[model samples]
Target: MATSNRPNAPELDSACVAAYDHAVRQGVFDDSDVAEQLALGEAEVLRIRTVLTDLRLLIRGEDGSATVPASPEIAEAELSAHLEAGIIERREQLARIHRQMRSLAPVYRAHRHLPQASQSVRLVEDPAAVRRELAAATRACTSEAFTVQPGGGRSPEALNEAIARDTTMLKRGVTMRILYQHTVRANLATRTYTRKVTELGAEVRTAEEIYERLIIFDRSLAFVPQERVGGRPPGAAIVTDETIVGHLWRMHDKMWQSASPYDPRDVDYASTSEEIKASILRLMATGLKDDVIARKLGMATRTCRRYMAGIMDELGATSRFQAGVRATSLGMVKPDPNP
Candidate 1:
């Protein structure tokens, strides 16, 4: 137990650190005495001992009853040796997995690129499987990628995850176009993300609303949300059918044409807010409920109701029906043709 040559310990909690320091100074193991010296409960003492034992600083005799504090040097050396052994084992395991996967790479390539009639559509019911499929599609993309994200402000975590993937494709010289609901203009994270990726040669725009989520690569492969039923968990449908992919691409093109290009520095907050209200008014004119309007506009129902209240007040109408009638009269929204 030579302190002079002991290496610095790995970062540990202050309490664990203090206990380790006490162990080094006392050069002995006595739970009662240690607890008294540290003013810690028996459970705390037990926890500290368990943690130190796991760290290899506390060693037990062959009988598994007598415990002793190992010198910091000995503990660090043992821990490093154990970790190096684990790393070697993991690297071997990884190499074995890579070999097995490489052996099947040709089979994967043959079936994946050739779309037989029976294999035109793949319903991936498992979320993890869907992600793997998406990763595969992303890797295979050569010409372009199109994505329509409908939920408005994406979570920061999701945006962070996508930035790397998006930039990688951009680096490969693949064209990328993304569409989102205009509500994203109100989200700081989304705005910042838009600025960053646009600088990297990605086209991003926002429409009043989007019907569904979509991801298409090279106009040959696409992923769409699997229709939900019976409380089933969400999944993705990988579509490689030429006709279906073409139709989806056309729809995306139409939306892209109608969408306004997003520029964080050039955003007009007042104009955007007015456009959202107008869209809400149009949907309201169609007799859509607050929840349905919110869903369509990618907003919360409460937010939708608040906007409705504001619109009604602005129109000097006391009720939703009156508001719609006034909006139509003022040419704010076209009259519902069926009505």
Candidate 2:
């Protein structure tokens, strides 16, 4: 009988030899019975017989009974050979991978020197400097741009500058997208700004919790605030690495997908209020106080309490605890629309 040429065939043959040895020692089965038990057809059984014969572990008698030979050296040698071949093949594969990595070392080293390198991130300290850097990044962009501004709270001057740049880019057919927090709909200035950008064909969406401002140009360069925009440092910037930029872009997309359309002056604050109410109800159900809920929702504590009062009125509750129970009973906090 011939052996298979498959990669694992030798190892498989060795295992078959071990099983044959066990069956022979058990003395409860003939070779044909062993073949049936092992689920191998006659051809495979013959191959095993040949291996066992080479090992001298089995002797064929004229009466058609099979007897075990004295030695186990042959089986041990077959197993060793199979294992050695597998190890050699694995080592060769690893060597190939190492050689490929070695060939890429120079390119990797060069990339580390580029502005996008991870370790040498620069900080832009002045607003003018930050704007200059962003403008430079815009000029360098060869692909699409993405941005996120939570609270839609850009300064009037900055907003005007961004609108002008976005308008110019839109006329030139560059792709741009921006995301804002749902609160933007209620901010007249932000609504007007978004309307102008939307007229130029840029995409805009809104979410409830937009944490930081992010701008990614061509999926390559990104700018994020190092200090909160209103923080005491005045103006501080952190130029992003490729990995962080990519992550920001992904997060922007996820929020954008969940945001409602930015309809400027036409936005319904009533719906926004309802969303706030629902969020308050969720927090209340968790036993959170108005102050804590206010911070989490990025609103004033008084405003949060006012919203809770409104929720109670809507649910016909006489107290805060009653409002929570009623909200749950009516399932008012069920999954909301993407916005």
Candidate 3:
């Protein structure tokens, strides 16, 4: 009678095939040793022995030892079975992937229309309205405030309103940082405002070029002017989302890092004199006339001339040419080809 194949025929066939190949190469094997190495029961080993014998792939030696015969047909049959199993597994895997993609089709379609379902943005028209909205947004803030005032000079009413809001917020313990143009250092009203605000614990700084005005509250809301406000109706203001507000706040932080702090009533005459001298040197290097230099530096003509006179006196020069030569020699002005 023919023997029944092992229950795990595929796995047993592959293992027996490998053991046969190795035995053929090595030219020796004990049946008990083979069964132990392959972790097979005696019954499974006996079935493998029968299968190999049927295939005419088993050899019996003179010592009753069992070994494998090198039969190309046996190898070909095992390889074909492995390839068939792999192909079926890959087809099933591809079908599963297609099912998953089909399940996500509705999600993809719903995402395409999400933008239309979002809320519509509202616009604020009047300057007073903008101010009111900004104040309202900031009033609820639990963190710090940042502001940039370009041109440094605002109408008295506008300045008063801003100061009042700042005062209230400061009283409520919100930290504030304000940036202004260097020209404000000379404005009495601006200086007074700075003095008052600094007393309330807000930080102030000055820079040379401030191109636009901005306000950010709690690093979450920001406002920027839409049009130039040079003696015309106030332009529209941009009330920002959190993402844009954070970006503008980062820019403000960069400028604040580079600006000089505003310290009121500290009489640093030498430093003031040095700044005046530096301004004169910069203006002269730019090939500007004294009048243009005066206007650009926010000083009167007489005041500009007085600074030049001081530069001359410091260098002990009697003529403009001598002053320029001495100023360069004393390292007061270095030639800037770009300027």
Candidate 4:
């Protein structure tokens, strides 16, 4: 028979191997009676024969009754040779992938540090360009990254994408700080996203209010939103100048100092809703309508009205003005020159 290339060939039964060992000690073996001696089927006998041949354990013999003894040294050498070949093959494949990746590194770096990107502040209006710049900066970031997601909630897909990106950064030992609006406490997707990042040693906090979206890579550069006015599409400002980065970092530090910790276990919707209603009460006392308050808090008007109705009912007030007075009496709303 001929040798085979399989590294994990069909297993030989223990009793059959013992029988082979006995035969090897006798310096010869009769393979024809192997099934009868081992109480195995013809298929099992054939499998053992094939594995022995592939391992170079069975020496040559034309007739089954004249088979030669096993050779352990030759079998070990053959297996070692096969393992060596597999290792070499894997190393070569990795080398090829590394070369391909290296080819793209220069291009990515060139775009990441373009002349326009080198400017004090770049006004990038295209969404695709904004994403490209962000991806480039994130890839280049070494020590740390910080982000502020001001809107209340994120889509499940967006949360998954963030988890994948931030997980890689965390694995590379990058420190991350993320700030969210207190409204995120009511958002399942946002909570899931923050919980995952927090588990990776990223600091997460929530505030009643946070500035517009910001992403800072290390202490070198920052990205902040360029408002969408009229009918123009929204964009971001890529700030590379040191002076601007310092200004932005200081603003972030101040907010982080004031933001509350995002405790994943605190999924108390009722308490969060009451707090939101109290905020609405204060805002309503200031004469902001339902729509304005809803817009200010990044929630729907109907939902805001529901909270307001609950507040009004609790105060036993028939009108907004009465509700304001009753809330003030209940210490839910304090009078202020700003309010």
Which candidate tops TM-score? 4
Ranking by TM-score: 4, 1, 2, 3
Off by over 4 Å in 3: 1-125, 152-155, 227-229, 267-270, 288-330, 334-339
Which is superior by TM-score, 2 or 3?
Answer: 2
Clashes of 2: 0
lDDT of 2 by residue, 1-339 (tens): 233354432333665666566666775335677676777778877777666665546655557655554345765676568667767877888899989987997886566453533343656567777777677677666668888876435667668887877777777777888887665566666777888877877888777666677888787677776655565434444555777767877877877887777667575588877776777788888788878777666667887788888778888999888887888888876543333
lDDT of 4 by residue, 135-243 (tens): 7787788998989887678779778867888888998899999888778888888888778888889998876656478888998899988886876647888888998
Highest lDDT: which candidate?
1
Q: lDDT of each prediction vs. the true structure?
A: 0.83, 0.70, 0.69, 0.78
Give candidate 3's whole-model lDDT.
0.69
What's every prediction's RMSD, in angstroms? 10.1, 19.7, 22.6, 5.3
Error of 4 at 213 (Å): 1.1
lDDT score, residue 174, model 1? 94
TM-score of each: 0.66, 0.57, 0.50, 0.74
Local distance difference test, candidate 2: 0.70
Question: Could you tally the backbone clashes for each prediction?
Answer: 0, 0, 0, 0
